[model samples]
Target: MTDIPLEHVHVAPDDGADSEPAPAVFVLHGRGADEEDLLPVAAELPDELHVVSLRAPDPLQGGYTWYELDLSAGGLESSQPDAEDFRRSLDLIVESVDAAVDAYGLDADRIGLLGFSQGAITSLSLLLEEPDRYAWVVALHGYLAASYASLDPDGIESKPVFVGAGAGDRVIPESRTTAAVDRLEDVGADVASGSFPGGHGIGPQELEAVVEFVAARAV
Candidate 1:
């Protein structure tokens, strides 16, 4: 399970140094999306970033999802995310990150995480549980899972984060979105955020902010 299916995008170093370790970003796609879904976003990011996108372990309807969502009550809820599956997926992500660092000779301290929807939830969960492994995070159109509500501030305080959502997103209600941001801020994460005037997906303005967020953290 640790050997996650991956698609790699190598960006050439501008300095022309053969051995200089370039910064890296692990791109996580939304529910029912594949590894290729976020590759374009990676391309728009700063050049020379080693991008590693992973496919979710569980196969869903026609694509992939990180975890199972129980919306039996007609509300967007994930109070139960297949605990065993989540553990396995989370473990694989950590293992993959470490392996990627070793194989590419990349600086672990410079690695950032970018994700959307379910991907975003996993990214935030991983960061909250294991903050030392990543430098920053960009979580789009997602909320903090109920399981991770009691995150310890000591482990993640001062961590850089960019959390964005759509004002018209019906899938994740505004209340949940607001709570997600408030949770992160209460935990002392350096949170920079924006809301787009759209639905349950990312938009141009959000992408622009993402670019700026990545650039600022890349330094």
Candidate 2:
């Protein structure tokens, strides 16, 4: 197990409006990507809200990866051996979110998580595993990992979730995306979903949907 530390860079509101006790959106990036890749997305979001983009723990060959992958194995390499270490990274992220909330005097009940691809997987997994931790979750171009099937949805029913996928996403099959949405709905999450005609990435329409979802729920 390797210890991975979560690193973050904050993007303050452009409005220069006095920072209110507003909820934050923690942005996570995809595989081989860095924290800066998704930080710009915050600009399109409501300026009244806070945005924090984080870097994954481990540095890969060209960039970074949240967990190791064995292409030969067909799926994620067993993170079991490194579960404790991996979880520690997640703990750091959670702590960071709490710190941001406290620092800004934001309403804890309004905090949310937003991630793309691998980051999306992490966001969804964390929310499912700790149902009461976040008020809302936005997963873009990411599928639900199988480990989430064991989660108890007692506290998650009222939590809002926005899931978006590319219709032409060859990496994540449409069936898998539909299944993920079904599972979340079944578990009581207020789920809203959409699919765009593109590859494994977010398009203009997808971004608009995300903005709407967050604006309606986070504020």
Q: List model 1 lDDT by residue over 101-125, tens digit each.
A: 8777677888899989888888989
lDDT of 1 at 114: 96
- By lDDT, who's the top model here? 1
Local distance difference test, each candidate:
0.80, 0.76
Q: Per-residue lDDT of 100-151 in model 2, one digit per residue for the tens?
A: 7766566687778899877887888889878788889999877776667557
Lowest lDDT block of 10, candidate 1: 1-10
- Model 2 gets an lDDT of 0.76
State, as a TM-score between 0 and 1, how close model 1 is to the true structure: 0.90
Report lDDT (Cα) of residue 106, candidate 1.
Answer: 74
